[model samples]
Target chain A: MTEHTVKSFDDELTHLSNTISRMGGLAEAQLAGALQALANRDSDLAVRIAASDAQVDVLEQDVQHFTVRLLALRQPVAADLRHIVAALKIASELERIADYAANVAKRSLVLNQQPAVKPVGAVINLGRLVQTILKDIMDAYVEQDVAKAIGVWNRDEEVDDLYTGLFRELITYMMEDPRTITACTHLMFMAKNIERIGDHATNIAETLHFLVVGTPLKGARPKGPSVEAQ
Target chain B: MTEHTVKSFDDELTHLSNTISRMGGLAEAQLAGALQALANRDSDLAVRIAASDAQVDVLEQDVQHFTVRLLALRQPVAADLRHIVAALKIASELERIADYAANVAKRSLVLNQQPAVKPVGAVINLGRLVQTILKDIMDAYVEQDVAKAIGVWNRDEEVDDLYTGLFRELITYMMEDPRTITACTHLMFMAKNIERIGDHATNIAETLHFLVVGTPLKGARPKGPSVEAQ
Candidate 1:
């Protein structure tokens, strides 16, 4: 390729990465807002977070369109191809992360109507951990830093541990007082959603590993506790 | 391109679809076996179902390998491109569905240790419903039938309703007898896992719609009662 062609390709790649960054920013904000809304029992903020998911959805569609166009038009080989494919997968994962946040917000809308539960602080703290992991993974994508991505991947066990603890606490609360059952159940699902968000971050980390190394991550993915069995 | 090249391309497409079909079949069987194990309290079958998830993971990697190669090599446009992309997404969704089945089976291992809850039958029934939906969606994928896919998509509400009902029943059981709380809680998570499998099936249905019609399905995705809030 000529110098101009190489420059334009680089520009397109940068553009794609920028779009993902924007989506990531939106997802982070939405997640933070959702957690805050849950903590404060702010139904209106929760409603806004739910509505703002569409912005992320539109951004994801843009990423898809641009990535597919680059793949077909440029027909990039080797690392470039892997990069585009990873971006595609990462965009999808981010969109789903946004959806989980929105779902949490929606639950908050309902939970707001009930008396607040004691475990809300734990849920918010879990959300903070997941949001930080999400931010780190997106940065890893931008910087192509495998170490950072792996760091985020390893931290998922912390999220899972918190989820297990929260699960037991919620179950115990529900068992002790029948009145808290409905609210605690909602809290449990939100905690699970946050746990799932952590899983998606690990997925992005795996994709980044493949993109960088041109091979799948070796060995089994490290899992903490099985939420289902708990 | 020559006619022979086109023929070879078509052959590759067929091979790709066949891999997906095998994956789908394996996933279907895994879900069925998991539910059966849950019903029979057969920890051996449950253990096997858990072990079989690796098979689905291998198949998914195969699908991913073939898909990335096709995208880079053929540079298929329009419907062909969409078909390959949809196949990639569907394979991932199917693998996740298998994971959910495995998770349910794992939960069954714990639940089986205790005396069976009366609501175990309800969990199995919900699993059966999700399994049928999964099968229908797979058929929709094989046939590329958007209408059939939409039919399956519409039925997710039914799965959600059943899950909501089952959630309430499990909570009630736990409230009535503390002895049943451990078993019922595990069952609740298993039920939620099945519901999530239905959601993944719906995701495949939406991907099918995009593959066939070249546009996302319109309007909000149909959601039943919010599990968290209920």
Candidate 2:
């Protein structure tokens, strides 16, 4: 409880936040690069994006180590405890988000070998939407803005709705032309990955909400219509 | 540092472990019931399985609350700290696995409304494979067996291979008979859900490995052949 101890604790928290921000930036770049690779059919760029995922993995380890140290040594109570826990959970979420981006890049590498599907535009749009949501959620975490986090949480419905429409469109494309099935299937997987990224963002938002407000977010998360046909 | 405090801490750990076991049992039942519903085309059973997902969600909240309290109050260091953190991550993974089960059940309900696809048997087999993997990983977590966890981790390749084969078969079914497209599409999503459940189980295995040892699992996880056509 001395001044030096408090300062060191604050410094540790700031370092954790900065590390997460840096990881977020890397993940955003990977996602954007993956989308560009998909658009241009650039297998080399896709490969590079996939390779860069190792950096994110390493950063996740650093964050985990730091967070655990803080929890054990500082024994942060109440909101402080929640903040450290949220950082821990958010770090994991970011790592998974990065993995999804890498998965998209991997899919792009495969898709490049085939004749490109016509629905790349829709996929790019979905990717961009998810990337924006991710950015907003990360900002919410840094600022501890519950309102901003909730905004990102609700925005996932948009991603879900778009995913459902794209799912149907891709399914139709595959059905109508057997030649496009292979490419469309990969694109469908990429779209689903993007959608899952949005879900991870929502999860971070919910964690942030819990950290800022003592209670967990009430009620079920709003889900868009199911993609299943009636 | 007192005997009573140590006894209480041990009791808390045991309770935490038991709660996770109960949650795992619920998730396993949900997965099995969903598969049974799919096999029998039992819409009622599927709906019930979907409804039961709320229980898993609640249990996840309980796990989170208990974990945070333990971290703050006991401030466990080293291996005990790692064990609690692993429990936290494993709980989230199990909740997600349960969500996948509920999603499969929801898909089953949709499939039940339509004429059953001939490939439902294949879907059931895939679900069973994933369920076995999930059960094995949970056991690894409880027993703190790194070797057993790694065994389950490597087995994920089997699920991925099965998913790839089934993906091709379903695509072929949709292509050859447009009438089966709707049903086949739903089945494809359910299969994907099962494959993802396998991935979640692998994630838990990695967490268990980390908890047992002090380091994260090394090397890239084994992946099956790409789903993309050559």
Candidate 3:
């Protein structure tokens, strides 16, 4: 309420934002490394991803503790409250997204032991799209760019479209050669996980939009099932 | 410091818990009815599940508003604060679970318009598993029964196994007769959604464990991709 308190609060909020961004950066790196581990079939890479997850976990907890303390101490309302909540949701989503990446890398290690079935091009493409969306979402949050956040949300449709295309192709492979079933199944899950990452990224974007506009950008409309079926 | 207000705060916390249970009941019903509708191809049942979703949405918003107001006014600390935070997370998950039920019903309406590919038995089985775990998890939350919550968390593995079996069967249908692909695909999304519902139930179970024990229950460590594949 006082001028001195306002200045101190501003400084604390800035540091809080940076702490969240640092955590985001670690999550982003985990996603990229996991995908690289998969592409290369490097078990060592997968092991490293699995091992380093604790760092992300630690950062996630730090962000949460700091945010909750800020909320309780500062009693922030309106946009300030929204920012803290956005950070909270973003932290949870990014942590889960990192877990998915670790899973994918682990699968990659497993797949390497077997003969390659088909080019993992489709799965790789899906990962790239999701990774870009994740990166852009963090950028939008840190920069406070509503336009960039909306852009991240719109790109989700494209990622879904790409995954659908890949699904159809996988189905064709299974139909033609049942032998490819094993590898193809991993591809299916890998694709699904990547699609979910895109969904999480979109969630972050929605949160950002709410922080900026003080209202939900999307009307909480339910998304239809994946288009990749037939 | 203030005995009278402290007593009232306890009552408020109790009411919040009760409200969450009421909402959880609504979501559980939606999930069960949607599954039944899909299995039986009952359009009337589908309509009912879809119609009830709006009420769940309203409850979700009410919980959101209530928790935010509680935090702002009471500025709860320690255990009280964790309970409210957990309620917020549980409310969101329950809302999303309801949305998944609506999704299943929508898919059911489409699938019903077509000829049957195979029996909806497996899809129904998966749905029942989800519904059971969801109900049990709520009970666990109500009683703060750590054992029951852990039981629900572990049951998620069975749900995953059931989903994998369904996928293999659907693949056979598509391979045998491409005509079955459309129906099978709708069925696949329904299965995926139910599996996700199981996941959310497990999440609620985790939340309960956290509240009762002051720590999170250790999960199955993400399974690290399947060496067995599918």
Chain B alone: TM-score in each candidate?
Answer: 0.96, 0.96, 0.94
| Sort order, DockQ high to low | 1, 2, 3
Tens digit of lDDT per residue, candidate 1, span B94-182? 98889988999898988888887899999999998998899999898888899999999899888888888898898788777877777
> What overall lDDT, based on C-alpha atoms, would model 1 receive against the true structure?
0.86
True contacts kept of 1: 0.35
How would you encode candidate 3's per-residue C-alpha lDDT over A1-230 as one tens digit per residue?
Answer: 89999999888778878877887788788888878887777789887886677787787788777877777788888888887877777888777777777667767776777678774877987898888889999998899999999888888888888887887787677667765655666677677777878888888888888888998886543354443321
lDDT to native, each model: 0.86, 0.85, 0.80
The candidate that wins on DockQ is: 1
Q: Show pairs that collide, candidate 1.
A: none
Record all residue pairs in model 3 with backbone atoms less than 3 Å apart, i.e. clashing: none
Q: What TM-score does prediction 1 earn?
A: 0.93
Query: Which docking category, incorrect, acceptable, medium or high, applies to candidate 1?
Result: acceptable
lDDT per residue as tens, model 3, B110-226: 888779766488899888888889999999989889999989888877888888788879767766776666577667777877887888898898888888888878746333244
- Write one digit per residue (lDDT tens) for candidate 2, span A105-189: 9989878888877899999999989989988987887788999998998897888989889988987887788777768877887
Candidate 3: segments with Cα more than 4 A from true spot? A1-8, A218-230, B1-8, B43-58, B106-119, B160-189, B218-230
Q: Which regions of candidate 1 are displaced past 4 Å?
A: A213-220, A224-230, B213-220, B224-230
